[model samples]
Target: MKNSEPIIKVDHLFYRYEKENVLEDISIEVPKGAFLGIVGPNGSGKSTLLKHLLGLLKIQQGKIQLFGTEIRSFKDWDRIGFVSQKANSFNTGFPATVYEVVLSGLTRKIGLFRFGSREDRKKVDHILESVGMLDFKNRNIGELSGGQQQRVFIARALVSEPDLLILDEPTVGVDAQNVNQFYDMLENLNKELHITLVLVTHDIGVISDKVTHVACLNKNLHFHGSTFEFNALKERDLSSIYGHDVQVITHHH
Candidate 1:
């Protein structure tokens, strides 16, 4: 691959679900080590787009490349880590400790029946420390708060040392007060850990302050640029993207 190749590239993408065109002529690029925040109103095809990136949905009328390889030919799935909204749906009653939960992330890599080696255990501990959940390693997964559980899940994803991390509405069940801290952790992952991040979230104001780039979508890709450029858009421009008047309140850190 060329040195300048983007980690993810979507070109002239189009998708339809039965009668509705869910995405139209969409295109975007995510460079390695960059933090990209995707913001859009509900039913704006954001999830559909993410599915394509994850290679879950077949590409119908567009091209998508991951790590410079076409999605159809990309086989290094382990290089990508995904944290979904379903994390909040995790069975809180499930009998598992935080360490076990994070270690499970390596099941695919280490074989389903094989136990983790000492090296693997150390890796898990390091990942937990990076995510600030090392102290809770012995705690029951069911005992943690939504925010803490999310951090554990992130550590689980990190255990495999993925180069790209994708999150879909990750803060769904987190308390309002802890949302900022959650985003702060994500920022550290992107900045300090140098993991490429593709985040789909509704927290536009908060995300705008953390992400290096922003993409505003509404079936079509309305905006894809630097955070500064996205923040400079007029309210009317943002309203047109959302199909209604909207306000973006930026929070300073």
Candidate 2:
């Protein structure tokens, strides 16, 4: 792919669930190394759009391209890492060490039945350290707090060395106090590791200072621009898109 090409491109996308339209004429481009946040009210089809990007949902109308290749023809699935809200649903009683959990991310590349190589183990350690979970390497996955577990999950995603990382409501179960740190970690991953990031979140205010761009979606894409442009939007404009009174809170670092 060329350096100027967007990592993800969606064009004239539309989706319907039986009778109602879930998404309408959605189009957006996520550039390489960009930290893009997708924000919308509940039932705004944010998750549906993510599913389309991940290839979990087949495209019914629009077209999606990943790594400059059309989604249907794209074969580099390993280049994209995904962390979902369901990461919090892990059984607390499940027995697995943090090290093992992170190491498992290499399963796709390592193939089944074969053990991780020493280099693979080192990669896991590096990823865990990057996510601030290396100290918990030997600890049980079920024993960590919500925020800590999320970090471990992120480590697992990073262990595969994906060029792009997508997170869907990753802070759902994390405490308020740790949310900032969690976002900071994500920002570091985007800036330092140079990994492109696409995050679906309800916390627009919290992520405003961190993300490079924002896409406001409510069935149709209401807005898509730099963080500065998103922040400049009037409350009434947001309210109109939300179909209810809305308030935008911006956090400044």
lDDT per residue as tens, model 2, 89-149: 8788879999988888998889865669999988988999899988999999999989999
User: Residue-wise lDDT of candidate 1 within 1-253, one digit each (tens)?
Assistant: 6758999999999999998999999999999889999999999999999999999999999899999999999999999999997557889899989999999999997877566999999999999998889999999999999999999989988899999999999998999888888899999999899999999999889766899999999999999999999888898999999998888887666
TM-score of each model, paired residue for residue: 0.97, 0.96
Candidate 1 lDDT at 63 equals: 99
lDDT (CA) per prediction: 0.92, 0.91
Q: After superposition, how far is residue 241 of candidate 1 from its true place, in Å?
A: 0.7
Please give the range of 10 consecutive residues that has the lowest summed lDDT in model 2: 244-253
Maximum-lDDT candidate: 1
Worst 10 residues of 1 by lDDT: 244-253
